[model samples]
Target: MATFLFDKIIFGPVKSRRLGVSLGINLLPNDCKLCSFNCIYCECGWNPDQYDQKINFHPKAQVKESLFEKLSQMKANNEDLDVITFAGNGEPTLHPEFSEIIDYTIQVRNKVFPQARIAVLSNSSMIHKKSIFKALNKIDDNILKLDGGTEETIINLNQPVGKFNLDNMVKLLSKFDSNLIIQTLFIRGEYEGKIIDNTTNAELEAWISHLQKIKPKEVMIYTISRDTPSDNLEKISMNELEQIAKRVDAAGFKTQISS
Candidate 1:
């Protein structure tokens, strides 16, 4: 297992492999792993217990005010901000006032750094919630994640509990008419005697078929660029990712090879 990469409520105006110089908005608590899916490949490490609770839910007004203050300081210093991203240690959509927070982030962003894009990196677990979908639509980049096409692999890797079946999740996600940048992390490993390989041709075919059905505007094909939770996990090679990108481009979908 890997050590948690971030520990603050608000972190990194740092370089991101996907988002670039992103100002992160941590919707989760400053500490703890709060999420619906405890992924094996999660850089935050695995929360096998699946105990996702809000330790400290900040008041929306306070969060907004603090953000405004930070933005003001950055503007005063003549610093550039590329993107304001919502990606904490846990699920960003789990915040009770996520929509309002997004509204507030946008307001502050426009007032201070109008050129910077507002992005939300989410796990796509709560897209079924109408409010969550509505909030995501407001962002410049709605980076949604759907790693596996099959229910078995989804359960094994993502480790989402309850009625989080792949079929239902896909059906729910289809309601989002907005162009979504779907992200899939392709990897291979063996967990508890079960072989896990999302890069397999069968999985790729299934993902492609689902992509045709969902019709996302773009797809991000990525591999493990950082250390993960499970020891059995293996990163996909660059050559393999490029091959996948070619197929995705051939299908008329915008694709980016990132790791």
Candidate 2:
């Protein structure tokens, strides 16, 4: 189960299944993964030993300069840019100057590519912080993760590094109401002798119930499309994803699937 990391602060304008041509921004360190959740399915691989690791986040000024330079070049060449996304090595919200960076990114995006939207692909672990939550709301696409309905499934799947409360997280998500887009990665497999599956009937029931409470603008349902850190994981099929999407649609939320 080999995985990789984004080696640059400002990386691709890669074709995304869910989003159009997206120019990515990596706020975390370039050398290693730094995140609150050490997800088994993370493409950037597992979190490193932080105790002995010298963690250094990309500075806000550097990020702004790199982004402006890239966007300026892309705009000059008339490159198709749909979104300026905050997604890379790890969780972008984990950066200390995340809010200020967002403000700068917004300014740059408006100046260079007004048509392009700003989006953040967050795991929803840091939304409890007022600054992070406010910054997320300011973006065009405030996508957040809600992988599991139950606390047990979330803990087993996400493996948050610190304290986690499913009830409180869902409640906080509800604050965004229609402004938020809930993203859920559905998978079934065994990890550390435990069977992990969020596609089960009971699992979907609980997940949909949470969606009903949150009332998000849209729901992004996806499965593993790349090599994961864990070898035993199984990717859910498109048909299965559609079935799950139907459940979400039935619950009265817009659904987007990327298989």
RMSD of 2: 0.9
lDDT of 1: 0.81
Models 1 onward score TM values of 0.94, 0.98
Candidate 1 lDDT by residue in tens digits, 67-143:
88778888999987899988878788888999999988888888899999998888888888888888898888988
lDDT per residue (tens digit) for residues 1-259 in model 2: 8899898998888998999999999998888888899998999999986534456898888998899999999999999999989989888998999999999989888888999999999999899899999999999999999999899999999999999999999899999967999999999998899999998999999999999899999999999999999999999999999999998999898999999
Q: Global CA lDDT of candidate 2, please?
A: 0.92
In model 1, the clashing pairs are none
Q: What lDDT score goes with residue 177 in model 2?
A: 69
| Predicted structure with the largest lDDT when compared to the true one | 2
Let me know the TM-score candidate 1 reaches against the reference structure: 0.94
Minimal lDDT window, size 10, model 2: 47-56
Local lDDT at 98 for model 1: 92
Q: Give the winner by TM-score.
A: 2
